[model samples]
Target: MKRTAALVALAAVPVLFLGVFFVLPVSGMVGLGLVSDGRFAPGEALEVLGRARVHRVLWFTVWAAALATAITLLLGIPAAYVLHRLDFPGRTVLRAAFMVPFVLPTVVVGIAFKHLFAGALAGLALDGTPVPIIAAMVFFNLAVVVRTVGTSWESLDPRPAEAAAALGAGGWRVFRTITLPALRTSIVSAATVVFLFCSTAFGIVLILGGLRYATIETEIYLLTTAHFDLPAAAALCLLQLFVVTLLLYAAHRARAAAPVPVERRAPGARRIRRTDLPAVLAAGVALVLIAFPVLDLVTGSLRHDGNWSLANYRALDQVGQGSLVEASVIEALVNSLRTAFDATWLALLIGGLVSVIVTRRSHSPTERRVRAGLDGFFMLPLGVSAVTLGFGFLITLDEPPVNFRDSPMLVPIAQALVALPLVVRTLAPVLAGIDDRQRQAAASLGASPLRTVLTIDLAVITRPLLAASGFAFAISLGEFGATSFLSRVDHPTLPVLIFRLLGTPGSHNYGMALAAAVVLAATTAAVMLLVERLRVPGVGGF
Candidate 1:
């Protein structure tokens, strides 16, 4: 009875948190959009949905995401394969650190890409076009393909390929017949996630694509904020919700289709071989490609108009005070850190409780299915656009039972919502793998259920939980999508401040933006490195 009560209590926390903060706001936002004046009107929703601009935005979102996914796979697959087969110094370290780009704020990345390609694309003025936007998507999302597929590729049985080669099969033929089949499920899962991210993209689309490009996410933001067309934003949110649901469902099915476990051994970075030089060089090249934009951003911040100077860093003080954002550099940094601290605690508390409820003692098929359903539920926030959620906050939080419209907790609440899914993803896998036999053994030894959980399950997840905390902190520091909508002038996070600075004219404003982006990048990188260093040996990554 005590154990049952504990389980119920554990489930209630996440259930209540998500229901009140997430589901209620979104549902209320939709109702506000569907209703005309005081009455529910289907005609208003239909009219918004039937607009020609809506069709155009939907089409662009689909095709651009498809292009980005295809491009990412084409390059990411080769990189994953090379990293898997090669044994060299720093290989394991590289794999663990690959999340640097994935964890970066999209607004910061958008700024980096603009500088990286500004000269190259000057002839065509590609800022408002799809090319730069899709490229940015690839830059940010390639890590997904590499991590998921590489995790699978590293564990593939090599004997089958060796046997095939011995029987006169060529390398390509061996790969086609043996290696490719083993990686299909993971590859599909990675591709679907990449596609979903690119489709629901907000920061890059807005900053890079500008007004010329319109994805459903960007359109939703523009419709509500720029146009005050709540009904239109609501319609797009519905369509977005449906599309994201399908993608999440597809990703879940792909992950579920894997019949065998991947990464059976700890990642190994053995000595480099004579034959491994080519793959090693390729890996080095790949790393450089990924690392250059960041390096350039740092350099660009310090070098102003060809003369290296501290002028840009000095300008940081002038950028905020009594200026556009109204907060000093120190104030913004303090606010960001304070909010991130609160957000990380919230994510750890809520996600930890949910994971406790999700971790099962039995490995039955029904239990597995239920676990997967729970996984999908937790991850839905990630798949759903942050813009949609932000708009939901605008419409729902101004009145009634919990009128926190101007409350100080709003920023951290938004940050926590954004970080919760990642926390769950980070912690759930480790928790679910805990053998029920451990609990059973403890029970047989006369330990109570509560004691069994404390000593067994909780003890095991300690390191991974730390990793989750790092992720939550990093997310809170770098998040821009929802923060763009929710943050007020008085309290701006780094990414939000950076976006505003970049939007303003003048070289001073531009330099300050780069300087701020550098700070945000450094902050996120430090958090992720800590995570990599402290992570549990065999746990999955962000």
Candidate 2:
């Protein structure tokens, strides 16, 4: 009974936080579609599903996400093996470089691809096609595959493969029969996550696809903002929610199917051999794909009127021509930093509590089930559309009782919700890995529960806690979909400001957008680099 009471106490703040910030806002948005004249009417929203344009959006979202997921796996599996299983010079730097794209703002990635096609790869003529969209999705999600599979690969026992080779099985035969089976779970988990991110991608599709290609995410934004069609937006949101929920559940089931445990061995990263040429070549291609757009974005920012100059960067201190933005690029950057700082702490607090609640050794079957349910509940932000969350906030929280339309903390709170899942994912594994006997020992020594946690759990999770903070900070810095709806004109985040600048006409505006994107990308990359240095397991993995 005491243990159950303690579990309730531990879960109370996080549950309340998620209920108010996440559940309430999403439910309110769905209500807007179903409730009319105080009557529950879902038919009007469902009618949106029959629209021709909606069909096109859904089709494109599915095929594009599928294609991107396939390409990411193809490139990522070889690279993951080369980078994590083969010791090579500059591997750490290369690993960090590969991770930068995942943390980059979607708006920045969209703009970089545009510049890449227009300036450097103009002859390809793939500027406004679905090709770039798919490519960008691969570039953005490749890191997920690498991180997830590579983490598993690093810890995989080599004896099975070595034994297979000893019996005269060829390298290809051994890998196909031995290595692939071991990696099946992580591969599936990564693929599901990549598909989720691709299908729900907003800023990339919005900036690159424009009117030519529309994913469900961008379509929802257009329906809400441009068309003022809340019902249509709500319909798309429901569709997306259904699809994502199914995908996440499938991933969960795949991961839960326990693999036969092997006797553990230290990572045996061998020196590169002649046989590793193919993987090395693949990794080279992956690096080029990651580097091209970033290099193009940097060079594009330095050019003005066909001459290389710092004019675009200098213009950041001033608003664009014709008052395109209410705040200067520099001011917007300040807003982003301040918002991210606030968001980091909020995510860490709630996510830390959630990690503890879900990871604690449950004494009863009911307690275990409750903890499992809470674990999945906090991850809803990972699968739900960020734009829906932000839009919901505006419509639901503006009135009395929960008025936050004018609060400075509103944007930070929304970003925190977007980042909370990452925090929980990063910290929960570290917490769960702790031996319960340590806590029992502390308690037997007459330590209070709080003191037991402080001395035992905190000691183990401190590094992971710091890593989670940096990871959350980076995610909050790059969050755009929700920030678009909630950020005020006078206090826009950098991503919002860059999107606004892109919409405005003028070479100067375009140049400044590139420069600002570089700044945003650099900030997030620096944070991620620090997170990586901590060597926290599952820092960027699922």
Candidate 3:
């Protein structure tokens, strides 16, 4: 009964957050699309659905996402296997390297990818286009497999595959029958995540695509902010939302059907002698693919005008100074930092509160239901397209008792929404793992619930909370979809600045964008290193 009450209380936060910001706003946008003036009218939606341009864009979105997901799985599954199954020198470093892309801001990724695909990169013929854009998205999303499925794959017993080998099963046969089945759930989970990412990709598409292609996200941005077509944007966003929800449903089903005995194992294994060479080679290639864009950005940043110079770095503070209250580029960096910080705080507070409440009384019926509902609500933000949410906020925030049209709070608010799911997912596992005996012992010794929690639960959860908050901060820093719309013109975030730099013509502009990307990449690397530092010496930090 006590636990039930806590869950019910915990349920309130996500429910209210999602209802107002997610459900209501999204529903309103969809309704706005289907209604004409004050009544129901599906004509605009029909027209949008029937257009060849719309179909082409939708097809591009689906196929590009599919291609990206496919490539991620190909690269990720092998890397996950190696990471999960082998013990080697620099294993820790390799693991950390895999997470670099996820921590980096997407805007930084866009700039880096653009530079890597530059016409003169590494004496290779390069041009920023759809191929490079898709390649970058796949690289960025590979970490999803490493973190989600790789963790699970590491837990799987090697005995199953060994047993198959002992029975004269060939390598491919054993993998097809035994190893594959064991990983099916995780593969689905990771694939869905990759798909979701590619579908709503904003920064990469914006920079590398260069107006040649448009995903639903790009289309929505063009429709609303550029063309001022609210109904069309709403309709496009609703389509994206519906598709994403379907994918989320599929992910939920896969997760539920996964075997319940999922276990964690220490990362240790003797090298598979015959397979070691291939594994190492594969890992090398994957690392190069993942690391090249970053390297390109860094190298490109330092050298411009046929020689190495700090001119780009020096110019960062000067750009957009006269046009805005603050130097727009530097202001964007400051805005991104501030928003990331605020988003981290908000995510930690709300996510922590919800995690505690949900796990308080797991044995009670009310608590179970409430916890489930809250979990669903928390995950809603993950499934909802950030582009769709931005459009919704654009339309909704203008009207109502709280008109935040010109508010600086809007950027962080949207960023917090984007970071919420990552924070909750990261923290919930740690909270659930807290030993009940410690709390019980404290209570028996006459400690109050608050005191017991402070001394016991807080002690256990500190590292995870920090790591999770770091992830939240990283996501918010890199997030571009919503921030682009919500951020004030004068207070543009780093990504917004990067996008502007890329859009403008000139080698100087491009070089400066690359330099900023290098800075952003450094920030991402620092966050991951922090997360690595926080790992508890036993359980791997996801």
**Best candidate (score: lDDT):** 2
RMSD to native, candidate 1: 3.0
lDDT of 1 by residue, 174-197 (tens): 878877877788888889889988
- Comparing 2 with 3 on TM-score, the higher-scoring candidate is 2
Residue 187, candidate 1: C-alpha displacement in angstroms: 0.3
lDDT of 2 by residue, 21-70 (tens): 88888898888878888999989877889899999999999999999999
Q: After superposition, how far is residue 362 of candidate 1 from its true place, in Å?
A: 6.9
In model 2, the clashing pairs are: none
Q: Estimated TM-score per prediction?
A: 0.92, 0.97, 0.93
Best by TM-score: 2
- Residue-level lDDT tens digits of model 3 in 1-542: 86666566656776776677778778779888999988999998878777787888899899999999998888888888787678778888888889888877778887777667664463555574578878889888888887777777777777777899999998889879887888888788789888988988987887777556889889888888778888888888778878888888888998888764345455466666675577566767788888877777777788879898987888777673223223446777788899889888977887788677656646856667767777666667776777778878888878767577777777787888888777777777777788888888999999998999899889888898888878888888888888877877667888777777777677777776777777777886898789877755434334
Worst window of 10 by summed lDDT in candidate 2: 258-267
Arrange candidates by TM-score, descending: 2, 3, 1
Ten-residue stretch with the least lDDT total in model 3: 320-329
